[model samples]
Every structure is written in structure tokens, then in C-alpha cells.
Target: MATYLDTPGRVCRSLSEEDMELVHALQINGRASFREIADVLGISDQTAARRWARLRSAGKLRVLGLTDPIRLGNSVWLVRVRCTPDAASSLGKAMARRPDTTWVNLDSGGTEISCSVRTRSPGPEESPLLQKLPRTPQVVDLSAHCSLHVFFGHDLGPINKRGPLTAAQVAALTPPDTPDRATDATPPVPLDDSDRQLLDLLARDGRAATGDLAAATGLSPSTVRRRITELRSAGALYFDVEYHPDILQQSFRAALWLEIDPSRLAEAGSALAAHPEVAYATATTGTANLYASIDVATAQLFYRYLTESVATLPGLRHTATAPIQRTLKGPGPYLPTTA
Candidate 1:
């Protein structure tokens, strides 16, 4: 167990305000080229490329395809908890190491620690996903909320004409990367507006059958299937489930945030990312900035793990937690529109 006194044994820093603005632009549309970001941020494409590279080397960002779990036949849950004022945060931080958890936020606004979790149920007849919650401790309060809507992924606050995603939501969905993109170009194909309409249908319902897709897309079933296949092959479409733990019976989740010494960031980040209970970790720019999402069975189980497992982690000190209400979105590339 690492003592609180040794907190921030290493430090991880986020981008500057200028960098953050660029990030917001890129995050709003990962497909945006350095040229696009530079155009928006009023900088040269070379400068944008350098800044993005720096952001990645700092372990501060990622860009992947985000998916919806409901269409994939999964469940979602929100777990909120409270622990000893001193113990509350540390407990949350430990459980975040678990793979079962997905989103973690510690000491969010003021009162509670929260985590939003998504789980894949074992079987339609078997509810191993929900029944599995009580097996762990370190949770005090657990509640459930539906992910009614997903307004935006990168930034959730209000939007206006000046906001990046406001007037151009759909147009902002797909992006074109800068010159040094991560991969080589994909071979081209022939899919016209009708084919695009088919894609739009699948976007709303990934599980839609070929016949249904064809009907909605105004194409032959075979053509629809071929195009869909091509899209999936081209890395454009994916299918997966989103689990609702509360409905399935496992509503326990929480977000854990840790503050570590700047000197120990690499070691600490690597160690915590590989922790047993932690699900997600983000190195942010604030006092207690290391954020992770965790999941556990019960408050008692949560307690045992914290006191026994995470309490002793090296290079860790101060901690905080909050109960998650819902997964704003499943663990896919949380992206804005292409517009």
C-alpha cells in the first residue's frame, strides 16, 4: 500500500490552453488534417503537426472509432459511491484498475465520486454481468441511469454559433487526417449517394439485416451486403453490445482520480494503467489529475481491495472519487460530427 504522503511521485501534464484549443478542434474531428486544425487555430500546418505529436508523446490523447453498445446487445450502468472522507478517493482510484470499468471521474463537482461502466452479459438466460457486482467491495452508494442521449463526445457543455460542433454536426462526423496519418491509404471503391444512404441506416442500427438495410437504402439486398462488407473491411463500420448493469443487476461503479509526483509519471502511469481494478486512466492537468474509471461488486468488496490492494500502490498519495451516472457513450472513439 502506498502512503498518501508520497502522492504525485510522478507528474503527467496535459496540453496548454492554446494546445487544448487545437485539441478541441482535432478531437471534434480527428479526420481533420493539420492543415484544417491550423486553419481553425490560426497556425501553420507544420505547427499543428508538431503540437499533435507532442500531445501523443505526453500520453494525453487517442483517436479511435466509438461504438454503441445497445445495438450490440449489451448493458450499461452507473455506480456512485462515498467512502471515508480520506478513504473515499483512494478506494475509487484502486477499483478503476479493473477492466470491467470504463469511465472514472474522481471528486467531480463537489459531493460524490462516480463511474460509468459498460459490461457484456454472459447469456440471455444467464445474468452473470449484473449478478457479479456484489463480489467486490469499496462502493458505498450505487445508482442507475439510462444513457438517454449523447449530445457530444469531446465537449459536453452548451454550444452556440461560435462553437465547433454547433451548426455543422453531421458534416463534422468524418475527418481527413494530416499528411503523416497513422496508416496508408485504403483502396478506393464505387459507392454513390445510395450507398451512402445505406451507411446512414446502419449507423443508426448496426444490427439491421441486409434485407432491412437494402429496403431502407433503396438497393438490392446483395448490393447492400457487398457495400456493407466493403465498409467494414475499410474500417468504417463495427458492431458491439452495450450492457446495462443496473438492469442486469450490477449497478456498482465509480470514478477514481489520483494525484502523483511529477517525477514518477511514466512509471506510475504504466503501473496504474495495468492495475487490476482500473478500467480507464487519463493524465489531466490539475491537482489530483490522474483520472480512472473502476467497477466492483459491492461496497465491502470495494473496501477490501482498497485497504489491501491499491492502498499500497507506489508513487501515489492524494485521491478522490465520484459515482458515475451513465456512460455518455460506449468505449469507442468518442468523436464529434464530421461537419
Candidate 2:
């Protein structure tokens, strides 16, 4: 087992260099063949497969196929809720169990919860962020921001930058870049029931064998492969590798809400997105129009980032930091704990 100190004045173990390399390879391409990963890492294919199995069985990593909300004509809302001290845990758990919520986390000393909500349409009635969350008596305050433009954190994740893979190794594992469909004018391809079923299975395990998927979905292996290609080409689905941050020796995480001059919003957002510490950055609608999630090794490093990386942004007006105390859900569907 690997670990890292969540707070100062504590020490914890972490993944070995070889394991970290394996993780980085998957982050580049979650569905890469074991032989491909082995070739890049200079290890045997059997070793690569064994390592991945061990990691997966331990719940230390997951490869998930995620849908693009924007491509599906949906809106993503970043919601922050302030709750009474005693109610935060239960509230966080409840939010995590919702299908529309991701990145559900406890923050601001466990008094505030932050999560992202995806809605199929643009109305208060259709959005849990607007309709259901504010109704809770234990919730003291709630704010939701509509994401306008994402500067980064979709195609690639923070691990790609922080992991130990060399440039050549990363390039070896990375698939060739294709034109982004999210910005194109093409209407999204509609998904049939079979498509949905395949997606659901992939959401649980992106690298599931084609035969298994065929058996589960009653589609032939060739059909499963073809559908995956079509969905990926249409930009309706993509893959993400999830793991504990401790594997990378990054224990501290925080969300940033920043107010920037309107004229400089695009420039600042792009600039912040390029920073190594930032995992996600987007422009949104609210008092603080820019939002980012950052991970680092320690509080001192975080301070240095604030001063060296963020302080110099042009037209910076105000900034607020909410430390993430725990994450209840990530990029994939939330699975409730079984009794």
C-alpha cells in the first residue's frame, strides 16, 4: 500500500518509481494494451498486466469512459454549498450519490461542500443545483456558476504533467491528436439503447475486454469495437484514468475562485491553465468568473504557487481558496457504498 501525508508534520509511504511509471502510461492512454505499456516502460508484458491487476484490485486506480456534457447539449454548473457543521458529511454523501454530480468534495474546513452538476437543459427546473440543493435546511448558503469556457483539464489531466514519464515516453503512449469536435458545428450523434449500454459498461472499466463487453451488451466483439470508434470520433465519449493523488506524492488540493478584469479574462484563464499545478481551469458566470483546481505537495509550495504563478496574472482582482478536505466522487459515476 502507498500513502502520503495529508497534513504537515506527518510522513507517509508512496508508490515506487516503477508503479508510478505504470500509472503515467495509463494516464496517457487508459485503454492502451499491456504490450504497448510494457514496450514504453521497458518491462515485460506479463509484468505490466500483473501490475495493473494488482493496482485495480486494490482500488488504487480506475479507467473510465466519460461522456462530454457539452457535446450532449448539457450545461455543467459548479456549485458551492455552506452547511451546518454536523450536516456536512451526510450532505456530501447525498450529493455524491446523485448521477449528475461529480468532483463532489468537502471543503472550507468541512463547513462548505463543492460539486459540479451536469444538466441536460438550461432551466432551474431541470437542474438539481438550482432546484433541489437550496431546499435543504442544513445548507446555509449555495452558489452555482455556469461554466462558459474550459481552458484545460478535459483532454489531459494533471497526472500527465506531474508523472515521471520522459518526453519520449509520453509521446510514445499518446495517441495522435485529432480535431476537437466539441468546438465544431456538427450536431452530436444520437446514442441508441445499445450505445448507452456499451457506454455504461465502459464507464465502469474502460479497458474491459471486447468479448466481455459483447457478452454484456449482446453485441458482437467487432460491433463493440466499431461502436467505440464511432462514439470516440463523434466526441461523445472519452477515457480518463483515476487514481489517488498520493501515488504521485501530491497530497494537498484546493479550488480557486478568481475575479479578473473582463477584458483580460481569456488571457488569464489561458495563462493559468498552462501552469503545472493546475489540474482544471475554466471561465464561468459569477462574481468570480474564473475557477481552477490545483494539487501540490505542501502548504509552502501552495504559497509559492500563489505568489510566483498566480500573483502576476494581469487584472487579478480577488481570489479565494477552498481547501478540499475529501472527495466523495470523481469524474465517473458515483457508486453508493453497499451495506
Candidate 3:
């Protein structure tokens, strides 16, 4: 459980080391049983459950189910919108409310908005970027970068690879990899109405009990379990954990866009992905072929990382950085509690 200071500001303290270990355990396997987690963490099951409840009630953490766009034959785009200074907040909130948008953020002194949009195949007239945004009067300019390849993010989120977990503990808690049934040569696994309903419920609470999921989806427990397994095995579903960044003592966040030599794109992307400061990295289309989300403890530390780590990347031709002022939406479903 977390503690709060009794100072004039009544500031909340950061999570304790044990609490972070519990968080890291869930990152390893979000659906793991409390008893299982306790066993690995060397704590009692009741204590583990109580700590999780406290953290969740405090809105410090969440577990969510996310889908893979490529596995589902969909596309993802990173859109940057330059709007009127006064309209930036409204436009950002509107975009955050859209089910298709995630990672909605306000940057560049509250005059620009950035978001990731997931879209199924749509005609030009139906495309949000191609048709809808251009018609908005308040939007001064817009650029949508189609993701060509993801070097990090999704199931390989920063916490999944780096956290409080020791090598032995991580290995003990890590679940076996689900088989990859989603291949380019194979057609995407089709989702039925039931599948959609299940996904919606899990998106809100990935660790929802099997019985609760069965009751909500109007299916037997066995059937619900089987379907979840099938979806995960097909690479169509995955669990992601979200927590307050302060737990990791990170206070600065920034978005980076870089234009790299085409021949060295993969090399540059991989190097950026491996850096501890980066939360997400991908190769995209447009003037800046590579984009990344960075997190650090301070602005000075960020500058150090930029000069020491990022500046040394191979074939880096041009670079642009925008400090993220606020995040309206995260990787999971939109929730007002999300920072």
C-alpha cells in the first residue's frame, strides 16, 4: 500500500519497493492468480490481494486487454494535429473520446495534439484522417504517419522488459508464449459478436475473473476460457498493465520523430527500442520515418539521453522532439482517471 505525506500540500508518496515488485509481477502475467503471484514474491496471498485492491482503488494501476492491429488485418496511424491555441484542449478531449484513438496527448505548448488511430480498411471518403480532419475549421494542419513496423510497444512495452523483477523472479512468473497463429500467409482470425463482447469487457478489466467473464458474456466458464485462449493463441488479444509513471520516478515525457536513412531504418529503430528511456518506438511513413515515446526522471536527464544515446543512432539525418504536456488517453480504454 502507498503512503501520503501530511505536509501542507498533502502529497502522495511513491509506491514502495514491494508494491512495485507486485506491479512487475502483474506485468509479467496480468491474469496470474493472487496465490501464484504471492508464491513468486514470497508474500501471503491475502497480502497480495489487499495491496492490489488498494492500488486499484487509488487509481494507481490497471490491467487491460489490447488487440494487435496487424493480427486483425487493421492499420495504425500516428496523427499530429495542429489546432487553434484555444481549441487544442477541446480537440484533444474529442479525439480522446473516440474509440479508435489512443495515446492521445497534448504537446508543443498546447497548440498541437498527437494520437494513435487504429482503423480497419476503409475507403477514402470514410477515412478519418483523409476526410474528417481536413474538414475541421479549427485544425490548422494535420499529419498522419502510417506505422510501417513496430520496433517496440504493444506486448513488448517498457515495463514488460524492465521493472522491479529479478531475472529469476521474472522467469518464474512469465507465462509460456501463446503460439503464433497470425501469420502473413494466413487470413486473420475472424471475430464474432460474442468475441467482440468478451473483448470489450476484458478491455476494461483484463484480470476479470473467469466466472465473472462467463456471466457477462452469457457463456459457460469453460467456453469463455477456451475463447480467450483461442484469441490469445491467434495473436489477436494480449494483456497490458498501466500504472502511474510516478511509481517509476519518471517525471518527463517526450515524443521523438526522426528521419533516418532508409537503408538503416531497421537498425535505428531497433537501437531506439532497446534504450531504457523509450516507451514506444516504430518505423513510420512520412518525412520522419521513426517515432518514439520517451520517459525520464527530469528534463536534464532527457537532454543527457538525447545527446548521449539518441544522437549516436546510426543514419540519423533529422530529429524533432516535443515534450508531452499531458496524456489524455493511454494504451487502454479511455478512463477519466487516466493521466
Candidate 4:
């Protein structure tokens, strides 16, 4: 069954200020209610709710709740699969359906499929594709980079319009950063069935109504709300808002592979995340210990960032760059109108 987000022939339009404001608000706090968002933006709750419904119906926006696999004591790895031309489409789609893979895409050439996969540990069936690919006739080559430290990914991307939300407005929308909440450095926790169900619903729409969730899960609205709060406090889930990069004039996109000293790895990753050009970055276990995604205005600007900015970082041993020809799947489902 096809969904509106993946349906064909959808119209792609640019977002207005109202739309942009709502998008930014969600980026700040994905679970904020229409009333809370309205309070911050000085609009009616109905208006905020209607606008969001329109955006989702038009396939212009996506809100996702994703678990940090690495923090969960799972192995996160970036994989590049080289397959025959005929097998590319089928192989990529097959990998995307797996619960383990995220950000799956067919790179510049259709023959190569690039994606990141997470696993609790190494086993024959830990990553079905990784193990099976080596023996499969169509898969010619495979490269896997184990993510050691993640500076940024998913929800950590920079917001398009930062100036629209005043400091007070942002503070109003944001949840209090309690001591129990997990940070990048914090360890992981175990999740129960209810937690998984909440995550599954939020993965489809982070702003889903508590009443709707209650209906689906056979739980009271209050129980659903309390569960969400508990999960958030445990740092078991975080929300990601997906939007078109071209809207912000970042047309050129590139993938970076870097090698750094093990001792300074976390420090280096943190520094890379501070740069606006870096949409994603991580420290992996491979020849190239670090990997990053860059979105810039022009090719020249990317070159300058690589030479001038990236060069200044300490313990940087080697670097490699690859351009992302196309994105088959991003944070959430690949939306044709939005992408």
C-alpha cells in the first residue's frame, strides 16, 4: 500500500513564513502541542493544527522519533554496497525495509548503495545484508565503517531560519533539560513494549495527538502522555524534523571521511558539529575514523570549508570526500514533494 508521502506526481512548493515558523518550532520541540506552539507564535491553536495537517497531507513535512543506537550499546556502521545495475533498485529497497538501516541511499552511481546500519553485536545474522552480501553473486564489493562517536546526525541538523524564533519563544517551546535526561555522553537504557510502540508512532509523526495514540494503543490519553514524558526523561528517544535543504540555499552536498587520533576523537567530533556546513558527522572504526555530511551554497564554498576550516582542527590525519548524487531515503520516509 502506498502512502501520501511516497505517492507519485505530488506537487512540490516552497514553505511560507507561517509554515517555516511551525517547522522551526517542531525542530525545537517535536512533541509540543498545537496550543503550546500557538502560544509561542501568538496564533490560535486551531490555526496551528490546521497548518500542520495541510503540510503532512501535502507531503511537505516529516517528524520522526529515533533511538540512538550507539547510546544503546549497539554497533553503528556506514556501509557502501556495490551491486550490478539491475540489482541496485531492488537491493536498496530491501535494505531500507530492514529495522536496522537508516539514511539509505543510492550514491552518485546507481551501482553503489550507501547506508548506515546498527546492531547490538556481531553475529552471522546481526546485519542480514552485510553477511549475505559477501556471498551473494550480485554484490561485488562491500565497505563498512563502524561508528565509534557520533557528533551529529538525524535531529541535530541546523535549523533553516534561526532568527524567527525569539529566545523567549524558544525557551517556551523547549522542555526543561532535567538531570535524568541523557546527553551525547550518557549511557543507554532498556525500553519496554509500550516504549517501542510510542517510538513507532512518533517515528511516523512525532506530533501525533495523545488521543489518537491512546485509541491505537488502548491506553488512556493521560497514560500515553506520561509514558512519553518518561521515555524523554530516560533519553531513550529524540525527535527529528525533515525539510528540503534547497529551501535554505544549500544546493551542494558532500560526504566527508576523516582520520583522527583516538585520544582527541570526541573533541574533534564536537568541533565539527559546531560548523553550520556540517549536517552530519561521526567517529567510526575504520581507516577513516570520522565521517561527515556537508551542505553548502556552492562547490567553491565547500572547497574553502574543507581547506580553511577543516584543516584548522587538531589531530586530523587524513581526509576523503564524496559527493551525494541523490538521497533515496533521509531521516524519515523519502518524500518526493519535499525532497
Write down the lDDT that model 4 would get. Answer: 0.73
Q: Candidate 4 has what TM-score?
A: 0.86
| Candidate maximizing TM-score | 3
TM-score of each: 0.40, 0.91, 0.92, 0.86
**What order do candidates take by TM-score, descending?**
3, 2, 4, 1
Report the lDDT tens digits of candidate 2 across residue range 40-131.
Answer: 99999999999999988876677888788777777889999999999998999888888888888889889999989988875446875568
Clashes of 2: 0
> Residue 197 in candidate 1 has what lDDT?
76
**Model 4, clash count?**
0
Q: Rate the local accuracy (lDDT) of all candidates.
A: 0.47, 0.82, 0.81, 0.73
Query: Model 1 compared with the native: what TM-score?
Result: 0.40
- What lDDT tens digits, residue by residue, belong to model 4 across residues 107-197? 6567888888777874325777678778878898989988766677655566622436788887788777422433556767777787678
Candidate 4 clashing pairs, residues 3+ apart or interchain: none
lDDT of 1 by residue, 300-337 (tens): 77677567766665677787665554333234322221
Ranking of all predicted structures according to lDDT, beginning with the best and ending with the worst: 2, 3, 4, 1
Pairs with steric clashes in candidate 3: none
- Candidate 2, which ten residues in sequence have the lowest lDDT sum? 1-10
